[model samples]
Target: MHVRTWADRINNLREINTLRNQIFVGFTLTMILVLVFAGAFIYGEVSVLLKQSAEKHIQQTAIQANGRLDVLLKQIDSLTTQVVTDSYVQKLLLKEAKGMPSNFNERQSLLQIANNYMAYSSGISSLELYTLDNRRLFPLDDSSIKRISMNALTQADEKKGRIAWVGIDPRVSDSVLAIRRINLLDNSYLPGGYLVVHVYREYFNMYESETEKEEKNPFRSRELMLLSDSEGNPIISDLDDEAAKSVLAQTGSTVTLEQESMLAVRQQSKVADWKLVLLMPVEAATEGISVLRTAIFVSIGIAALAFLLLTLPLSTMITRPIQQLMRSMRRARFGGLRVIPDGRNYFRTLEINELNNTYNQMVTHMNELIQVVYEKEITQSRTELKALQAQINPHFLFNTLEAFYWSLEEKEESELAQTILAMSGLFRYVIGSAADNDERVTIRDELEHAQRYLQIMKMRLIDRLHWFIEADEQLLQVPIPKLIIQPLVENAILHGVESRISPGSVTIRVFSAKPGFATIAVIDDGVGMDGEALNKLMQSIEGVPSQEPKKGAGVAMSNVQRRLKLYYPNTNERGSGLQIDSKAGAGTTVSFDITIPPEGDGLS
Candidate 1:
């Protein structure tokens, strides 16, 4: 049931076009393609390796089988040599028909000789002698087909010298037989008799028993057979037509029997011309490969399952987030803006979550832009209104002050007229300008403004008030903030010299103090305040803005400090703001540094 359900789901997937389905299908198809190519490669490689291994194993078996057969056959051949050279056998074979003993006597003599040699024989168990006149002149036992085999052996043209070699014959029953001719001592016309040795076939059978015991294979069986190379011979075998034809034509290493579904490995006998062939079924030859095939099937299934299990969920994790992002984009295309589905822990990857955060921030910034535009419109309206008022006020104030100055001048009130003119210029210079306090002015402008204010105050106390202004001509053109020096000079006149009886001297100095900077100091030689007053002034400059008049005696000085901070702004590193030093009845000095050799762009 589960298998059927999986099959149904797989069949249904071909009809769907969704992202997740597409991703799953593409990944599955790719894995299947790789596995299919790999399986074909593995199949070919494994089959070739097994077949070559089978051939090598059969070659070794042929060698080993031939070795055992050769050792026994060699021993039998050696025995034949020893028997032929024996004096007793020679005497029995050379005896003429007239001089030959009676049958009983001959039997006794031959038996004695045969027994002597047979005692030491390795494979042969019987020896028989035949005379030219008799079919059997032997003291040994023979098989029932003696007459037929003797005639066959006697007529064989393979006879050489007084003796000759024979092979494992097909006609005779499971034995090797040889014949020897006895020649006259001095003549060559006729031989006296023949000697025949019969070797039992039990030695060959012993090899089969050993081969079976050593190899206990039950999957397939093998058989060993010896076949003569003679024509018109009768022998049965499992060899198919191709193998049989090759073995008959010549010796070879291996042949496949298609008809019998078998394989043959052949070895030619060195002792004779016979052929030894080892037959094995094709089914048995591939038995090991069948087992490997089963294992490969199991492994393939396991590997496929493992591959899907490990990668499927991971691919979905990656593709799922991308799919969700696409859906959000699709919604955003229709609507104004749509937020992607997201939370703090929305994604397993921190990078994905960060992307979500940046997208959200972009949206937030986009929404804030609307309010920013409205605020900008209101600010623009107020700036225009202020611009209109600024255009009218300074002109009216300057004209009215000019009229008062001329009236005072016509009455010979030159000092008073000068004061009015200076005041008028101060008002017009400050109010008529569009530049703010933070904007840059030349040192020449700031110093001249301070001098005008001092000149106005000097008229009130002509005897006690004295002042000096000193500045480097080159430093005069450097940028400074407007009204900064004038306010400090005003504070010194009212607060430093207001109660002093001695002629007080106020000095304004400007000069380069370090690389890329210039200092401006205002000094008043009046009765200086105590430590408490100086500390309060310092606190007010530090932005405390003290409300008590006694502790906050420096509203103008504090304002100057704030302006310095706004203009210079490096309080911690460069000591740019106001520095104050005072002693009772001695003096008070307020000094500050501004960046010099200005970039000239200034604070526009």
Candidate 2:
């Protein structure tokens, strides 16, 4: 009745305690199935043995009764032979009675001969002779199938065979009759007339009657039925007529009717074409079996109950602690990064409590270590700020000497003085910013630094160097990683224009690339790298594979790359801050992006 698909069963199993329930289900099912099969097998075997024993009893009794019936019929057949041999009866039958009004003396003589056997044999109903020629009234006693009707005599003439058992004769009181026709053949072997012997029903029912036996027989105490096929009619029974017919219609040797729970068994007559059926109530037959069944079921139920009771505590011990641990873990996952506050109270087992305690200590130590690390970073930052400040004064002194030289008049020398003045301005700008740890600078500050450095470079390669700065004026004040662009310019002049035969131009462009982002690109028309060399240089900038050693062509690209990544941090695909595009004999352009926050704010 609990119909579910395999998929549904599997899903339900997934949502349950798999290990404990699997064992319990497997054990319980195995026990139930084994017990059911065992009980069914015993019941079936016992029923079969009891039924076979009962059927054997019925069969033996039916055989004896059938033998008696056959013997009685044979004796009646023998009497017909006696009557035919008698000289008086032969003359009476062979002589035609068709035209004669009556042959009183001849008929009387025939009856007298048959009366000898009739008197002794209680089964015989009557003996009579009839010629084939006529349907006339004779002094014949009444019985089944119209023995006295001329139409009946003519009808009996159609039966060319002999020795038939007839049941339920209308002419008698529920009596059975046997008709035997003796052929009175003349010399030509034709029927002159025939004799009939009607056997009494009492003879067959004699053994079946209650008065016949002293001891009670289980198979026969109840109604015993007998039916013999005659002519074309079915076997006849005297029990509950409807129930009897229904049992007769049953195909199996035994049938148990549900209404009355009666068990009916059918048997075949060995000596006659009859079926013997015995009817007994089911309760009477299986009264003791019901008690046995109850005891067996109780025993099985008790054993199963005991098994389930024992498993309850065992399953709880295994699953409860695990459930508690998962509950704590779930709270930590969804609630907060919280540890078990009281390990001993939370867990019943010692080892589990110890494990919880260990995890709690680990969390505590990790938090303490984080605080120590934060303090150390502040100390290191302050020390680096002091060291950086120390380097700035010397750089300023060199710039002051240039201001003194600005008084000279060789236009070129004055240009050199302007470059030194620009360099000094760069030094002051970098040093006097918000704080040492604040690496974020405005786009305007970065470009100014790059401009000063380019001015200084123009003095070195005055005629050979050409440069330009293009920018979106609105993006000039956007916050960017400090000193990010200035280094790219230095690298371009050093490895690019410095080595090229032709004069090279360095172009710096700062623009608003999109909403909330700014781009700075430095392009140089110089000797670009070959395939292998470019690959090595790109690897260093990207911090993937092994970096090229920081000497020779390494330059300031690596430092620019590291700082840009620290600020922009390509956490999503919208992407890397630094881009290097170059080809051999063409040119190199390095570009990077920076956050363009609101005017009052800077990069976080």
Candidate 3:
């Protein structure tokens, strides 16, 4: 009977598992289908937005290009007008009308003037004069004047004194040469000769570059072409030769260029019959529409997926308190300790809710215990720090007194005695005993302390050093950080002045730096650091880690930096900041600016 009962139980358990597996599989397939559709929709929408942004950007770029092109056209027109009305051209026309001898010198002079102008303007390729009376055209050459047939000029109407920019010559050349006619008469106005200047292609290229700079967008590529006539036969093109020819064949008010689906807008040149064609790729021109299509598809796919895969399961899981507890616990490892929600009857699972309630109660009790321990530890740390400070105070006081005692005992009479007294006073100020005294001590007192330190160092070095302290009397009483000058002096003596063979001198100068600041510099003439060593020294002064400390020196310098930070925390602009200037073989200068805070404001 027991064996039969166990078999029945096994069969029931298998059935339950099979049902759960079927439900999970069905749910997964539904979620995946929804996600796929949603993804497509979101992708479509994003594509649309991107294309629209691109189109707007291109349109603005095009407008800027057009403006620049307009400016270039105006400049060209002005240059042409100046050339036409030039005095040299008028003199040549007058001389030709007077039936004067065909003087070679006079002709040569006129050619030189034209050549000079052409050289100055880099745009003019050639200058020609058409004499109506002679029915001849004179082309200016480097050394001689050549006469050519005036057939092209005969077609030009001079009766109205109208200036004409002729269309591009199909057979003779690819350049667009224009003519301006002036009437010449003796005392009475009559039709005279015409002067023509051929513009170089480089002129147009410069204008194109200027326009491109003004536009400043890289994605939208642009092509500029100058057509020979209004009918659009190519004269010059920024595009490939084949593309230009194909585009010319499709000439219209707005033609779509062949080979590539690009939109071309025709702009008639103001000074000539040539047409300026602006072509933009069709993909670029209608980017907005394409992007919209893509974005719509992507957005729809995302929305569907979110509803199926994310919303349904998340909603069910969120309602379960035990599941919420598990998630919160995982988050706590990353420092996100949060309260777990209480489960209601509406929740899908009752057992999970009961589990969550038990876990929350346990967590609450543990949190109170942790908080008490954390507070106690912090209190203990503060107590220990106070004890350390107390120990440091007495030790420093003992050292200062011992130094003072030795100075008196050794019979160091003059400056040495004064320096020791200053050292004692400085120690008193630092230890809080001198709080009732002037918070702002004289620069003179600071220098005395530095001098004292130097005296002690001189004892060690046996008079191998000299120091100069120079300051204006007015600056002596300006407030400064206590002991600031001493360390800098010590640094120079130990690292700089002492390192040299010859007797070296250290100079301390205090001067006005800028408004609200004063300058203090320690300069030493000794073997200076190389660039790399100087850099390391600067890093240490700025409190950046350096290899020098591991090699075991620079402790005093590091301590100085720490004390500066503690006393003048707000004064340092960016943390760990200091400046040092030095060159190898040349000495180093260490300088810092001190801004005296208002009276009784303390170091910062």
Candidate 4:
């Protein structure tokens, strides 16, 4: 039997391993294929987009280079025209044509004029003047004399007339080579001596300084070059000479050439009949994109690793419970009344355990509901009995008082009329038409009721009784619970003054405490209570004992305590604002500090 169990266990293990292997293999293949296809698609699209972007970048560079070249050419043309028409140059040309002798003093004056012009013109290398007659050349410097001839000047002035500008000469070594002639007028007559201005190439170089200072990405490799009129001939570059030459030859509408893994942009400038080329390498342009791609691949790898680690455990947890339930249901043959031992040990899910607990709790609550119904019925019967007892005792006492009043009247006892009248008033107040159902009365009404009760008791112990009532007029109108003050006064009369043999006195005082509370205190000069009796009185007042006999002073006192608790359960510490202060053989005071409920809080 043990051998058979081992074989079955081995078979189960093999089956589980086979199932796990198939699931893992299928999931890994699907994820890998999906990731590969997505990566390929993204790479292809990004490559095409990057290429188009590079082309656009080159086109924009070309446009900007062309605009800058045009601005420089216009500025140069304006400067040349201003120099040739300068007043000083016109005066010098006029002086030379007047047949003035070629003396040192005359040459000195012309040289001074040329120096003044050079000061104002930033790129003027040399200034020269040639005459139609070969008498002399003024300010005859070495550079000016090297390439000067009388016929050459006359021919230049004839071919390109007044205000005409000649093209840049190859023989001139300056960056910018241009010459312009000004025809001198002798009192509105044209002269033969021409005013010539030679502007140097360094003027264009000054503009290059402004370009270098403009902000550009420092990481990008850039090249700026000047091309000769032979459109493909490269002259000078800010980068490698060989690279500049190669870049110039490839210039077209737009072109990008790959150098290893880097891309270059070739842009041309056609202003001044010269090409300006700019080359940028690609590695700098796509550095951010490469970093973004690397981050995406790293994130994918982390997610794949986490998924692999969590799969087997998550799958087992999900399937284990269903497998157990299926096995149990099969063994029981799907019978309803079979005892399926609580499966808390067999199940690992908290939700399933909680569901079972809730079902058990529902059954328990149903049983408790039935028990609550019986307790409520018992409580109802007790309430009815208490109500009946309250009614019988009050009615019997009122009837006895009425009979005694009639006997006194028959005997013609006129002196007892005030006492009898007081008795009648007391009975009327206690058994009055049930209070307005609001359970509250003004302090004036409550005090009046207490006075009538004292008057009736005064008649029974004539001449031995004394009482005083003092209350603030403002507190008299404040609302308090109906019989809240009366009970304490009754207790003072029955327990303090009545229990003594010597002549006793009772005093009732009412006063306003704060804005929302009133105080009614009953004090007696009769023998006060001992500690034991006081303890019993306090316990009875607190309703500590529910048994019949132990409820001190019978229904009236107990009912008052109950009503106070029911009405204001949260009143002060001793309950209902009722407080007792006494010492044996000393007077006792029972005070009711009643809170005046708000005007609209069911208190009329």
Best by TM-score: 1
Off by over 4 Å in 2: 1-128, 133-165, 171-174, 180-195, 200-259, 264-278, 284-289, 304-544, 547-604
Question: lDDT scores for all predictions?
Answer: 0.69, 0.66, 0.63, 0.62
- Give the best candidate by lDDT: 1
> Clash totals for all models, in order?
0, 1, 28, 2
Name the better of 2 and 3 by lDDT: 2
Question: Over all chains combined, what TM-score does candidate 4 have?
Answer: 0.43
Per-residue accuracy of model 1 over 425-508 as CA lDDT, tens digit each? 788767755554346688998888888888888888787788899999988888887778987887788777776866788899
| Model 2, span 51-167: residue lDDT tens | 566556666666665666667656776776676556665555555533453356655555556678687777777766655553321234222333444543443455553444444
TM-scores of the candidates in the order shown: 0.48, 0.43, 0.39, 0.43
Q: How accurate is candidate 4 locally (lDDT)?
A: 0.62
Candidate order by decreasing TM-score: 1, 2, 4, 3
**Candidate 2 overall lDDT versus native:** 0.66
Q: Rank the candidates by lDDT, best first.
A: 1, 2, 3, 4
Q: Considering summed lDDT, which 10 consecutive residues are worst modelled in model 3?
A: 140-149
User: In the order shown, what is each candidate's alpha-carbon RMSD?
Assistant: 15.5, 13.4, 27.0, 15.2
Model 1: lDDT to the true structure: 0.69
lDDT of 3: 0.63
State residue 489's C-alpha deviation in candidate 4, in Å.
Answer: 2.3
Model 4 alpha-carbon drift over 4 Å, by segment: 1-141, 145-352, 367-438, 498-501, 527-586, 598-602
